[model samples]
Target: MPNPIRDVAPTVADAVANERERQESTLGMIASENHVSEAVLAAQGTALTNKYAEGYPGARYYGGCEFVDEVERLAVERATDLWGADHVNVQPHSGTQANMGVYFAALEPGETILSLDLTHGGHLSHGHHVNFSGQLYDVTQYEVDPETGYIDYDELAALAHDVEPELIVSGSSAYPREFDWERVGEIADEVGAHQLADIAHITGLVAAGVHSSPVDHATFVTGSTHKTIRAGRGGIIMCDAEYADDVDSAVFPGSQGGPLMHNVAGKAVGFTEATTPAFEAYAEQSVANATVLADVLRDRGLSLVSGGTDKHLVLVDLRDSHPDLTGDDAEAALAAVDIVVNKNTVPGETRSPFVTSGIRIGTPALTTRGFGADELETVAHHIADVLDDPDDEDVRNRVREDVQRLCETHPIYD
Candidate 1:
């Protein structure tokens, strides 16, 4: 394999080398991250990146887009078919931009948008203060049930009715349970609000029919290509065909300048691959592995948010299990032993987001590498052991050896 270096600067080459080393050496357990296929990587590095197709297919502002147009058109068609979408916009550079396009197309500036609170699992683009979504729009926040650690639909509906928001954003970054989109849709309709499902993490599950589809109920749906989709980095927006022109214009001129045709082609490839029976089996296994992992952790006396999981991710509340170990400390300790995960705020986090009370782990990437319930159980055991003795070097060393052995059997993209 050729390195993404030599022709690049030494600093850039060193960064690439470090990234490759990190991926090769460590276990990637981060819920929002994954390893892309070689085919997708190759497509990303193709010559299409050299061209700037400023507009949509067949209506470009610039010429010499014949091949690029075909790639983008194929991406649009495949994405629409993949998600059963009436219309698809393959132009958004990331999930954040996809969301931006939706807002730009549907809502006026400073209109009220009801979204889950950031510390409680909502994304930054969903209306965190630092983000443009918060600065440009009037945001109303919602929270998970203090007892259940899940979005209480009854409470959410009452909030929606009270705020009468112009848009209601649904999705989560750390939530473990399945969403009730139908009820959410009903609440949105009652308030005359637009419902947008930011299913960035569960797009693969939805694609394989393993999770609930939001396209049927939501006015717009958005997702990242890299996460569960096992594709390259990009974003897609799905909506009804009647809004196709509005979405297309919003993406092309309102949000991003030029579409990445190479990424679009890779997305097309991913969409095609996601249609296979193997992909369905893989998606199903992803959920099963997560369920098994969650059970193992809970059995070890670790408190899990939402009690358990219905998808690939689990949120482990470390405060009750290890009172002294902050989420940041636990995350660093685990990384030293080759187990990777992110620190996340739980339902009622006592600490700030920077030093959260919980850690988020997911099995989709590992499951994609052929790991099943047995391996995940063992992995969970080692993780628990590491947490139980975070200061013991010998214990960490032993866990490191176990992790290496486990990862060897299920080499990603081998």
Candidate 2:
């Protein structure tokens, strides 16, 4: 069947087709991205997008919400089962919004927030000066130990005691290791602070049991559905039943108006897919691929933050191996060869955020494309060669051909 949008709007259709082709042709190594199944794609494009479910299931302000209420209920139930949460809210627009929901529900304005520093493998929403969380709260930051490239729990505890924050956030955007959730929870309890664990980047791994979950250790848990989980694009909040009403209200009447029911349906489908044994195997392989890639890079003389990864990504700090090469330059060089990655700030970054000292490479998208250890090893070598001489046209051309071949070998959608 012909696409109705293509028949009506050729320009928009052309852009959509080009975007799909782009994804099919490139190696997506960005740490926070993954390709969802065609079922998820279709669900997000369904007629449910036209409906506005302004409230929770059976409590919506809008009429004709029977079907959408069922969709939202399934999303909530499947997510709760997948993550083992007491309550799940699948209404937030994005992971940032999900964090906002927690903040809005838990604290008043000008309260203190203790989180990891942005340049030290933390997220902007955690407490960056430009974000709303920063504007509304007194934000104090903790950093990784400079020598070990890992969070310094002693310093974090000390800072929490000194700051006496209302909330302590535990999560990262570029850190390449697992967090000690129980320890963090203990520190929060000692400091009399609420713990908000943002698992946005590793939602799928946590769901598949490849990574430890923070559901029991945290007062609230939030994640992005579309990362490793391969859900539709949106965020989800999980909390205990006691906080359920506050969280739901914060998500709906506080931050957003109506829920995107189509995306909720996609979440329901993706959460169900995550419960399968095949997905468990896939999550395991993704971490294995990342480990192989990390070893290959380290063997090639690249310095990895934390020395390696316990998850699906590895952060390459270019300051040691290539002092003159900025992360932006490395990102551009990889992009030239059709291997896409994002420039990121390392634990002890000395450069600006836009021109950082590191590049983050992930295995989730490539693994979703059916890549395993051997393929990831080859890709890692290609990446090393390009970073070794980013200005070399011959090297770029050779890697470009190999990347094309790899993409063709592990094609994504039909």
Candidate 3:
């Protein structure tokens, strides 16, 4: 098939073609990314992109919103069913915007927000100094135990009492273990604070019942549609009926203008796909693959945060094994071999965020491409080999061959 974009814009068509080729050739181990199905890709490219749906279904500020309203309604309904929420908003452009909706609805500006620290497996939107959450709120951070690489509930409780925050955020971007959501809810109750659980990375796991949910414990839940969910790029917010009006208003007028109807249609298609038993099996395999990857890395003498993972990603702290190596060097070495992974900061990190001592590898995209335990084990060894001697061109060449073979064996997107 001739490329349509090639006829109109050759430069953009070249970049798009190159990017698609990159995804097809490389192993995407980045935890925050996954490849959506062709159905979702088609939905996002539809003519619905031309519409402007500014309000919720059945009530819109613009004309000719009936069809776009149906798209948004399907997205909201499927999300509500998947997560079992009293209300769902599928309007926010991204996860950060979804979180902003909750904050705008629940707290006044300059009010307190207690959350996890960024370097300690927490997200920037979780009140880091550089994000809007930190700029507008009195943010206090809690950390994982330096020795065990786990959340210190005792310290968190003490901090909650000391700060008297109006809102408490749960969920993380990098921590390897499952959170004790019930205990965090207890602390929030004791301190009279509302809990916002950001399950951006684990939405698919949570939906598949592979991971415990925060829906019952948190006052609000926010997640990205693109990550583990394999959906179009967007965000979702869920809350009780009482907060539904506030969340809707916050997302619409407070945070953004018209909703992206095309993305919403894509989300609807992905959510429908997620309801199938096959997707549940995929979610389970993703966790199993991560576990196998962690085991292989550990057997090769690398240190994993929390000792291992209970979710879809593993954070490797390289300071103990490769004393001189940095995450940047490892990422580059692996990228050279067509293995894509991101440098990440670990708990008690001494290096700057740009050049951290850790790397976070995930299994979602690989799992989607049909990689199983045996394949992951082989990939893990290749990773360890490169990291063990990144300067060796011979090692890089050998691993590059194996990676290419693997990509050929499990081709994506037909």
Candidate 4:
């Protein structure tokens, strides 16, 4: 390659270099984000992106897709081995699109959908009013128990019985506890509704057997191939063999056009990695790091949603400890110290989602950078130090030194 883009478009090249510097220097604690391996990056940057594979393997609407078919088939086969699903579709552009594929395959417009509320750790694709899911369907929502910070299965069952929804969604973007998929399946059965579990944040954990698999419980399981799995930027859908043709048709002719074969190649590479022992260790460490983070923050007098975490992320509700502080305040303050995290809405939030009352932190990226419990504990102290006194310049300066040292010690992609 001549690299004319860098020669002619120096400004864009500089921005790309800056972004690489930013990721290499700062701590990436976003729950929905992860750094892909260099191999995955290489696969995603290939010439496969130029192809137009508009249909499933061996049956494409476009020509010259033989290699792309191999990539797609490899992705689906590895995905089946990873999740134990009967069928897998690797073409959805994102997790939201994957959910749409399932909904289109099974439900008609105006059918009722019951899902967890967004403020309680649910995703926007799960029928948020602003998304197409909400606009086209009659959506009802469930909430976590205020007293115990857990899903009330009894309440959910009662509500499902009351509404008789066509589909019931179970999964959360920020939920720190493992879901009881069997119980959710039981509730769906009682209401005569289909079960769709969106495991966008826990795809790797589930693949590694650290979290429960919804493949056996839900009628349809959808997830992002990125996030914890580090499979470039795309989505996947898994279902029974009975719905395979319908799901595939809905994904191609019903919703999207030519597939992103470059991303599919990345998914194939990542899924192959998932079948290894090292990936299992990574998943286990991710959860352990989150546990340490929650404990360290709580010891510093901060309140954690659900009181603690059983997953790879923690939601810190600052309302009880720092009533004057909002999630936005904590996020911006931490970012200034090079400790990246996101503002999030807590259950029964009294503030707007924009400001929020909580910060959601995760360990996948940190773990990928070779972080362990001790390192994460130190990172937690830095976060607590900044949140404890967001206005103090000395505190921020001191935390900045510590963060830079840690980033140097565990330099990513170096």
RMSD of each: 1.3, 0.8, 0.7, 1.0
Clashing pairs in 2: none
**Candidate 2 C-alpha lDDT tens digits along 1-414:** 788888999899999999899999999999999999999998998999999889999999999999998888888888988999999999998999999999999989999999999988899999899999999999999999999999988889999999999999999898899999999999999999989999999999999999999999999999999998999789999998899999999998999999888899999999989989999999999999999999999999999998999999999999999999999999999999999999999987889999999999999999999999999999999999999999999999999999999999899997
Listed in order, each prediction's TM-score against the native is: 0.97, 0.99, 0.99, 0.99
Better of 1 and 2 by TM-score: 2
**Model 3 residue 138 distance off true place after TM-score fit, in angstroms:** 0.4
Model 3: lowest-lDDT 10 consecutive positions: 72-81
Give the runs in model 1 whose Cα sits over 4 Å from its true position. Answer: 1-4
The TM-score, computed over Cα atoms with residue i paired to residue i, of candidate 2 is 0.99
**Residue 31 shift from truth in candidate 4, angstroms:** 0.6
Candidate 4 TM-score, C-alpha based: 0.99
Candidate 1 to native Cα RMSD, angstroms: 1.3
Model 4 clash tally, residue pairs: 0
Worst 10 residues of 1 by lDDT: 1-10
lDDT of 1 at 200: 93
After aligning candidate 2 to the native by TM-score, how far in Å is the CA of 278 from where it should be? 0.9
How displaced is residue 353 in candidate 3, in Å?
Answer: 1.2
